[model samples]
Target chain A: MIGSEEVERETNPHSIVSVENLVKSYGGREETVRAIDGVSLTVEAGSIVGLLGPNGAGKTTLIKSILGLITPTSGSISVGGVDVVENPNRAHAKMAAVLEGARSTYWRLTIRENLEFFGRLNGEVGTEERKRHRQFLERLNLTEKMDDVVNDLSRGEKQRVSLATAMARDIDVLFLDEPTLGLDVEGSFELQQTLTELAAQRGVTILVSSHDLGMIESVCDRGIVLDDGEIVADDAIENLLDVLQTRVYELIVEGGVAASTRNEIERAYDVVSWVEHRGCTKLTVAVSNANRIHGLTGALVRNGLQIRSIRMDDTDFEAVFASLVYDRPHVDESRAARGER
Target chain B: MIRGRRGRLSSSVSILRALVTRNILIMKRYPLNTAGAIIGLYALFLLVYLGGRSLLGPGFSGTLGALIVGFFLFIMGNASYKTLAGLFATEAKWGTLERLYLLPVKFSHVAVLLSISSLLVTFFIGFTMLALMLLTTGTSISLDLVSILPIVTFTLLSTIGLGLLFGGATIRYKNISSIFGLVKFVFVAFIVAGPTFEEVFALKFLPLVQGSYLLQRVMNEELRLWDLEPLELSVLVLVGLGYFTFGYVLFRYFTERARTAGVMGHY
Candidate 1:
């Protein structure tokens, strides 16, 4: 998908958000920390990008630079074709962000007032903007609480209001950090659904950064993973999985396996995680070779351990992320310890 | 959506209107806070008037009229100073400061709109408190709009510069709010400063003091702004413009520094 996009000069012509070699460093020469080191990527129009990274992986630094919250030490960012560094005010009109999920709106302001304030600031006026406001209120499910001050809202409701407040603006791009942070199951699902609608229906490009891999899997068209201030992987979610061959499968056994079988299982397959749950052992086994699942299952049954459930976990982004950053060497490490490398 | 450079005038008005609307809505929401502010304003004035009266006894009547004018200017100066300087810190506290930076216009443009809105509100509150003080004391100064308006405008203009400077300092060195709170008390010094432009020519541009002197004359002598010496009026206008320009440059510098430092949301 990234290759299919048309390139004009260094950046894709259709990309609503583009950054080239962005480098942001903090502190001085003796002990400089490059928070963002030579990062470059482009988000095409209307695509939801999930920026996945561990803590201190430069995700925040990258988002802040693109949003014009902070200036990059080197390189360039452009929003909707306006160079961010050269003309920030012009680029600002094209972007908005819910940086801290629920704290974006004024706590003392009523939900409607917050919307009106942000909306008007985005250049939407009186009667002309009512329809847009009404639509988002309805979609975000804040219609009933429109008259209520934000301070009275529950955490979930407040997060929705924050999203609504940011989205109410006339913007071509929206950057959300931890978008599903305060949401429960239904709230997170609804937010994903709304984000899907925003991208698909309105063609509003979104760049979402969250540790919620499941939510990211459900909503994003592409996933970009960062590690140690550099991008470890960037591609379509399915492609990332396919290329990494992250054939991770979760095996829930009826009971705990004997020490010998467990040791043998660890030696045979790459065990990503082993946990005991409800008197059963849950082993996340990574099958590097896609055809090796049957061998592992046969060995498990032959060892007198009754199989409870077997399903491929490759569709889970956590598996793909682990393969990318935790490194595929996890299996190689296990094998090489026995001189298999 | 942003209508490009062509939308400059319209968007500016829209932004100003939005700020005014947001402010009024907040004020309307907290009626008690608004009322409390007025009462607090009056209480401070009364405290000063009583303290001075106690010290001077009956002779305080001679300075009563001057004290009233000084108190009015102090309210304006104090409010003006706090409004601009405290704005960034409060917004940062509320988490809306970054949003202001994200506006289509320069961040300073948003500050100006905010300043205009606050100016109107502070003026209303200041005048109301002024009225309350006059009613309690049964004394009135010349309320000539032609004379007082320009002088008051210049006085506010000068503090805006301080606001910008302190505001910029806030982004770089956050949680300096207590410093701004203490700085407002310096208005007392401005109030007591020598009021003669002829005595000290350099004193003409001394922030609130010079404006206070001109305003004291306007209220006491019923003198129009034009009635003042040409040099005095020009210098007053220049001082307002000069301080504002100084403040804006410093604000821009600190804002840029804050961006480089990436500490806008530190507080």
Candidate 2:
């Protein structure tokens, strides 16, 4: 049993979405697979929540169940106040989503037409609502591609159009799964910026799942890390970083040491992971403890290694993710089950 | 706040409408199939007309008109089935169904929408064949708006129901593709060689033959429908209603199962 304070700490503001003891299985004949097992979480309203999991970690399954796209074997999910399993239509009314691709819209229809279709489907498409649709398109930087068919637009442009369609729905809850997948750097940054603004300005309860840890960190307020179909770490971004903290440092050498000397210095640190690029051995040393750096560098000095500069790398976010998912034999258990099936 | 039966109904309708519109747009992108269907239907009508002329000679005129109309209905029904199944199988193959499953709307709505959108393909063909037949043959098939309207409405409803049923089945069972194809083949074959089979079986429950019988009634202007056996019309209505109910139940079942199994996005 989870305490109320723990739940509150996990879900700041107000928990608008609650999922309890969710389980999902597939292909029940001679071989059945459990995709999700006993997953539970709370997502607060007006806060961007990141549901982070590796591929086949039941991330998509969990998201679909929350949206009432699937039923749970045993458990309950509610969007707003409506139970998703019992009252899917009511639950869906409060939410919208952008999956990997833009199937929510028509392929042949122009972007504006797609928006009109979805908006009208949501009863928001009217002569009076076209302006609002246009505003959303513009906000998503999709106005330029508004008249283009989805198949005609670039991947990023199509993604923008997809985002615009969900935005046109203007629902209270938004589910974004790998929203930045298959996007270029500029497009990814642009999308991240748009999401940040949308959540901050519109008070939309957004749930995002993505492999791009950086993007999730930048756009989300809190994140839930899932492994083996269970919530392992649920915390705010700052707290997650704090929990997963590891020592990473940027090291600069005055002059290039011999490969052998560099190897010895590398042996001195726990791990020397860097490359010699642009006339600099930009090494990242992983120290067991902060005090170990003195002896670590002393070994380098004794080995005639000139250390021109060294700076600590921010290890909060990366360390948090690593700690949550890395070296955990149980995480491998999930992978093994998936592979077997 | 909008918690009630009416709210859910409206939401279902809204989602269905969205899915249908999306499918219609997909059809628009590749109008080749729609155009091919219209042309193929007209050709099929021509063959049926010629077959009737040869089989029953001048005495076949009234029956030929009815046959033509019946052929159109069967084609419409068959076409509806093909369109729905193809949409599902192809979309699943192309990995689009996963994206659809991720949406908040029910999968049943998507199935219904697929059926609705598919109607455009058959309707276009059905109307085209009707126009062409009227222009060429002009064999009075009774232009009574009253009888034609009800029959058209019922026929469309029945076709949509079957289409939904087939689409729903395909969501879980991939073999449903072949099932739909086999269904279309059997119906088309039955229409071509219905008379001999009707005589041999003497079964009144068959839709294809009954459809032909209704068309025959329409062409002869015997207009004795209200006075005729009530059970016949009731059977058709019951069959259609049965199909619709079965489709709804199956669709809801598989949708719920898919959701829980996490196979909703397995496609």
Candidate 3:
């Protein structure tokens, strides 16, 4: 029998997945590696969350722990209200995942057979459930290749088959570890669109860990950034960019600036780089605040520099990702200001 | 949309069917490999029989019968002991371990289902080997259902337990092939010693040895289960239950350790 409090906690309704103070460490006596160190976050139901990190950043460890594929050294993970460590079968019933690599499917089994097998394994035995398997194949554009053996299919087709098999089951949460890795631009875009639609139409809460920043930005509603076994930032994509203070400005000056003026400009702004070409000096500056751009341009005008053009540069997701994962001064200051200790 | 949950028994049956079907489909794709393995096993058995006959005198008919029964028991036991670990290693290497673990069933159930499926294949191979041996050697073998069923069941149960133990070890420590090789040698020694010498009381306590001795009596000497001493029957049942229970507990313990260490999917 479950207590009322336990039942309520398990059926939180708002969050599809919740992890708190999770820590996983390996090794003993002499050396120790803390893979996931005190990371806590909640993924709301029906929202797509991007787990963004560089290599060895604990993204896979966190995902594995949350899914109950691995037990954490400490803390707790609850999926769809059930504690994963305490009730793995119940927790697993609510989730499905497409793991890394091409090993997710049996190479000898046909695409249709693989789907049918996985569907049955996940408790989708009814005829209606079988129909859902076919529907997933159709949606993934794998209907015609359903009878083809997995080994003969291209890498992209095999990945789509994997996705289709996972999606065939009626699960509340989906975990995808690098789903778009090694895919062509079109293939990546197709998967991104499919994921977006799946989340939108079926209300599936998707937690995807990927290095493709552009795909993550387009597909994920929120982003959780990890760095060296810690949660560096967890917020909406735009808010994450803001928290990292990633703002870029491009300025064109007509006159050749002397060393004194260049030094003054560097002192006034965080000059990322400056290049002179065809008698025009193009200076790219990064500022912590958007408001500082106007003041810096005014200061340059006051220095008797002819401003040919001044425009805000479009900051892509890559710059924000690099700032959050790598050691950047602006990111360090922003983290300090946020008091995320 | 998700449907209502099915009964536990029904869901388990479905999972078993799917897993078995998947393995069968993969096996079907490699027809030549399957045939080669069966032929190779038969050849090995033939070589062992011929070599042993040459070493022993031609008048050793009774000893040869016991040896044939011992070989059959050894093959069955070896298959039971290796199947779970072999299947687990394959799944881990294929990166399907985590996916399989995600099924809405207990991990123990998944292992049991997979082992059962593998046992079916082993049974086929064992039967083929038995037929080939009987035809080639022209030995008359008889099976007493009332006597042989319980003995065979207990023997397989004990062997399956050993398999589960090794399977759990594989989950914890990947690349245990060397350890398996050593274990196979130990099992072969037990099989050879169990039938060759009847003076050692301690030898009967080893896994499958006592069962092999009893099976040989039923198959070769036509001894019914009722004719066997009550003490011998009791010992056989107790050993089988004890080994199976111990192996089940050990496997569960190792599985938990592997899960906590996050190495369940690592090969």
Candidate 4:
């Protein structure tokens, strides 16, 4: 986790978007449901941040609140240094979004009309001004389908059109929710490239939420994982791996693990996956401490289970994400999970 | 300070033009729907004109001028009542409602712009239906823009206000088209209320009913808006502004509730 000093710096002049102590609650006073509970974070300019979470994790709610699509019960959200609640129109002028539902464009309007209409809505009416938006279509490989109505396009094409529509205007910050949901490999890659270029070349900050963990790891500069309406993990991509500190190992044993032995293993190790055959058992377990490796093997041998092979498996961001969100005991969640130190 | 906020008039005009163009293009794409609506409206008017004339017999002193003016105002009311509410409900289903809030203007601005767009098109259709009625019934009426425009404006404003109330509710409630049957009954009452009923103060206050009565005065008596009593004009203007302002406020309130409740994108 970053120090408090880093958070202070991050929330300074360089921060284009800042959300503070946001809380959105539902239901009567007798029963309360908070969609986002005191979730705070700052997105610096020209950075790509991935919002990762399981279903019903308040990712969409957070994004919506930041975009001023939904009002938080109590909090402050600012975009480009403008308070969203006090002056949403000004905040919207500096922002754009491809929300969760990929139906932002008029289904009957052609791609050309969608681009033109959105451009004009954002005050980019001139031919020269609109021509500047062509790069979005080109990057999404949708320029050739300019005359096609959104209803006629394939699912991937429709999503790209939505992306192009969101990115068609001059915007400093862009919010996308599950943008890669319906995209194929090529479309996903092109979208990633577009995001990278927007951040690297234009200094446009992006906050995207998607279930595709691999894509988030590959493209995003930082990752934020939310669970149960709170931000449980927020850090750089590499730092997330470093902070997880858990090792995934594969243990192949001769003769299957009896129910009693399996129960013991479950009690000790964080088993990621388990498989058993006629005379073999393959167990993929996550061990937090290095000393637990020998301990596990010694216990297995003591239980009359012969260890055929033991090796460390590959580790990815998913493990780190799972550790933080699943409330694993090894990490000090209060100190490590909250990236604001 | 909105970064690209223009002088009031210029930005309003730009957004209105864009919205009008969008509505026009979408309407053009569905020629069948437009043709079907025109035919259905024409047929309904034909039913009223022919059936009323036959039912009352010759010397049925129901002047075509009043009928035409009343029809025009009714059409205006119908447009005002349905356009905003229907557009919003459809936008919710299309999942485009929340996206409009992303635009660099207030959602109310877009709502007003959309109402204006639909009003302009409704005017076109109103005239077309009038032409058809004139041709079919072999009737004549004065078409004075000077006398008719003010009444039409007030009537449209009142109906749009009523529509905004529903439009706002639809964002949160999702499906409320069941109330349309009641609106149809109200239209019938507006047409059938007699001169005796006009004596009642409350009857005179019915939305678009008041405008219809004022309009008939112009078409049948050859009067202009200027010749109308100050009390008459004042009451109409007051009702129009009052209903519209109330509806607009309700719509804004419902919109905020929708945002808070998180149902804007749900159909």
Candidate 5:
């Protein structure tokens, strides 16, 4: 039987942002684009929700509609408790967003000025709040460039300033669209750390769209996967892994190995994929039962291969997202209509 | 009762001031670009002043002086609107306008802030030119500063309102810069041609042009105070209100359209 607490958690109405049947279309004569279809989802208070989708999947459309930056052809959106269509300004009072490419800043403005502008726009924060915003900027490693023009900063630094500006308002909800699109490894990690602290310490509800599957897995409590402008999967990060029941395996063959033997091993078990690198045949096998790998190894040896190493691969979001979404049939353009639906 | 309701309406001026202050602060950080633009405006003024002297004969002094003043005003309005257009254009290009659309504030705040911020820069340039003119042209251009003060303020407001309207269009239409250029051509022509004193009788309803004509008439050594009409003053005020409302409504409409397209940031 399902636990009472589990049911309550699933049915709870404490979400910060909620949308139902959201739709958006553009253009008139000759060409029309249905950007968002019947998309419905909820982002809980203080939880980081990851929105993952391929290009042209209407992720931006969905985000814009929720923010009331765009009107929906048909749907309902509420930020906190205010309806977006009925009262967009009131609904927006609860949310702050950092859009793609750090476009939220005036290039001529200094980083400090950018923050000041956003803080004033938010209206809840006064002049004294600006002094506190400096501390936040320093924490985000933007103190050194406080007086530098926004256009002069590097792309990563510009994004940092954007985040600093968004954070200055201390809003209850934050929406980040591709926050770490082109950041280097260090920059991406630093941003992830800051997001984690913001959500954890401040109880801020965050909805993030990112290509960084690893960061999403580590930081987000739940994820919403969009395919063809529809919600394909909306579940906890752990549940997504459970749905894609596949584990990575690293195998090392010490003896001489033939390509045909590799083929024979593949014939014995579900050889999802494998790579031969530096004398090690690393295989990613999708075994229904864990014990099935032993039988596969026996078959490999009988086919004239010596197994020197066998290691169960790490279980993480990147592998799960790849195996579940990226490796699917949609990557083939022709098959898009079939599986993407 | 309606006037009371209108009086209760909140002033967005504070919002505009905050945004303008921010832009000024930003310009301070980029001193080189600001200095270069200011110097460029001065250089352009000199070129026009010297070049026009030879082309036109006796009336060159008064006409050129008036044209330069009009030119500065025209550029001031254009520059302010250009800032708004640039901000919207850049945001649309970079996908930031999408975020701003999602914010809680009124979308009008976006245009208002841009118009105010850019006007500050334009005013600085105009003031500098006025100072230079005072030093060079010792022939007292009447210097009827007292009478022209209110007219100047109203003129600036009407021009800035036009800027906001165009800025909004830039957000909705990606190639609005071409349209802005075309509109500016016609506007500058109206300002420079002095609109034939007879045209003022017809266009008394137009704010910026009417205000400019009234100021010019009042400041002219030959014109008399008895010639001024009460209807002209009231018409100028009405025209100012009209432009402000027209610009405001148009801005709100486009902002909504942009958001609905899910391309508020679409370049």
Candidate 6:
């Protein structure tokens, strides 16, 4: 049963997918696995949301529950304002999913047959719909291979066909699980471009789950990071990156500093690693803010240490992801340093 | 706005047509396998009859016509009985069951569509077997088309219901092929031995007994549509509808259980 709050949220016209307090456990008493634990999220319409998680982080379980493929232990998932648990068929009518593996299509059929069959199943079998399906094929660069058997196509081609079949349907929400698992660099880029275009042009709400952080960082507007079946962070990609970034500097100093000055420097910054080489000190310092680099240099100069060279560490999506999931205390240095007591 | 009854009905029909067409296209790809199965079953039956002719003597001629009709009905009944379960197993193996369930339509609708398509192919095979039997055995059939149609339809309904019941079991158990094989063996034994026995009241409750009896009478005893008593027709109709409804409900129940267990794609 959905709570009044969830019921109210379901009516949000901008929200295409809403999941509240979803809990799913599998297996018997002694051997059960709690796949999802009190996870809640909302995917707005016409936006691409990236579901990022490590293995066994309940990404697939969450996606399946939202798609109405698996029943949750206790929770409510509303897709396009329809409760998927109570009226799965009705809810499924407004959505389509391409699972991680190519298990969504018939391998024995040709590409065109697979698209046409799924289109018919989704009630998109009109002449105009068929033309649209062909246009999709052409846009995906699969027109020449339309007649080829799906089993005969390469894995990348098969993945494209799966995407085409899902896109061929006029659904409000599209769920893609690991859409670029085995694609080459070029294929992955092409798929990312297509998804971006599809969401923008067709106003389709997409929830994509993938380990390709670069792709997720490039294509997604929002990121929902899950760790151990709990949401660790949910925000816009840029904001998440901003909040999760840890500014670290690697420095080489020509003159050795006194023990008191080193202690003061350590008190001001997180000295990740320090070593001495050839009468010089090398220090890796993590600061709360990038501007604190000037303070660190000033403190060092006050101790009469000659600063040779310093470089800020390059931060990417991978770094942000690692910092969030690993619970690295890069974000809250004051609290972390005090907690060490 | 909610979809009206007519709209839902048309959508179901459209999905059914698509499923049937898909199955037909797949069947077309394996034409030789299809033809081989039909011819192979018929040839086995022909060889058995020829090899065992010595045991019957002259009495065989009197019952040859009945035997031929009974064999045809048996083959058709067995094929229909196994179609649903076999299709379910194949779909699970192919990883297509979950995909079908993901559609807006109910899973039972897909089962029914597959059953109907299987029946069409079975009928085609039955006719081929009948043709071969006529050519080799030099036997003439007295087919009461009007009477046979209703009886065969009812009997197929009941058999299909059993098939669906087994198909549902397959979904839950995943490795019930051996059980299906055993159940099918029992059904075959009943089909062969069913009409040979007298019309005991208990025999009517068996899967194909009552309908096969009526069908045999139509072929050998020249029973017409009106010749059947009202009670007999009522019994056939009740059994047909009863089994179909029971099987559909049972299949739906098992499918729901499988869904909750999250094993729809586990086979």
Q: Count clashes in each candidate, considering only residues at least 3 apart in sequence or on different chains.
A: 0, 6, 1, 0, 3, 0
Q: Give the per-residue lDDT digits (tens) of candidate 2, residues A167-191.
A: 7766888888898888999999999
Question: Which digits, one per residue and each the tens of the lDDT, describe model 5 over residues A1-341?
Answer: 11111222243478888787787777887897777877877678999999887777777778777877778988889888789888887777688788764566777778877777777655535667977797888789889889888899988898888888888776898888899888888888989999998899889998998777888888899887776676666788888767655566667776456788767877777777666777666666767667778787887778777788888866776666555456545455635655653
Candidate 2 lDDT at B242 equals: 62
Comparing candidate 2 with candidate 5, which one achieves the higher TM-score?
A: 5
lDDT of 3 by residue, A98-142 (tens): 885555888889998898898888764678987887777778898
- List DockQ, one per candidate, in order: 0.69, 0.45, 0.59, 0.57, 0.44, 0.47
lDDT of 2 at B96: 53
lDDT of 5 at B8: 21
lDDT of 1 by residue, A185-302 (tens): 9888888999999999988999999999998888999998887677777888887667655477898888888889989988988989889889998989988787898898899999
Segments in model 1 whose C-alpha atoms lie over 4 Å from true places: A1-11, A243-286, A293-315, A328-341, B1-6, B194-198
What residue pairs are clashing in model 1? Answer: none
For all the models shown, what interface RMSD does each have? 1.4, 3.9, 2.3, 1.8, 5.0, 2.3
- Candidate maximizing DockQ: 1
Which docking class does model 2 fall in? acceptable
Give TM-score, chain B, model 4. Answer: 0.92
Ranking by DockQ: 1, 3, 4, 6, 2, 5
Docking class of 1: medium
The superposed Cα distance between candidate 4 and the true structure at residue A272, in angstroms, equals: 8.6
As a whole number from 0 to 100, the lDDT of residue A260 in candidate 3 is 88
Best of the two (1, 5) by lDDT: 1
Instruction: Summarize candidate 2's per-residue lDDT along B78-106 as a digit string, tens digits.
Output: 77667765676666664457545534555
TM-score, every prediction: 0.89, 0.83, 0.90, 0.88, 0.84, 0.88
Local accuracy by lDDT, each model: 0.83, 0.70, 0.81, 0.80, 0.71, 0.81
Can you write out model 1's per-residue Cα lDDT over B1-267, one digit (the tens) per residue? 456667987788888888889888888989998899889988888898888889999898888778888888888888878887888888888778888888888887777777788888878888888898889888877898878888888888888888989999999999788888777777677666837544887876778777888888888877877789887788888988898888888888998899899886658
Q: Which ten residues in a row have the lowest lDDT in candidate 3 chain B?
A: B1-10
Give per-model CA RMSD.
5.0, 4.8, 5.2, 5.0, 4.9, 5.0
Question: Higher-TM-score candidate among 2 and 3?
Answer: 3
- Candidate 1 TM-score, C-alpha based: 0.89
Model 2 vs. true fold: TM: 0.83
Ranked by DockQ, the better of candidates 4 and 5 is 4
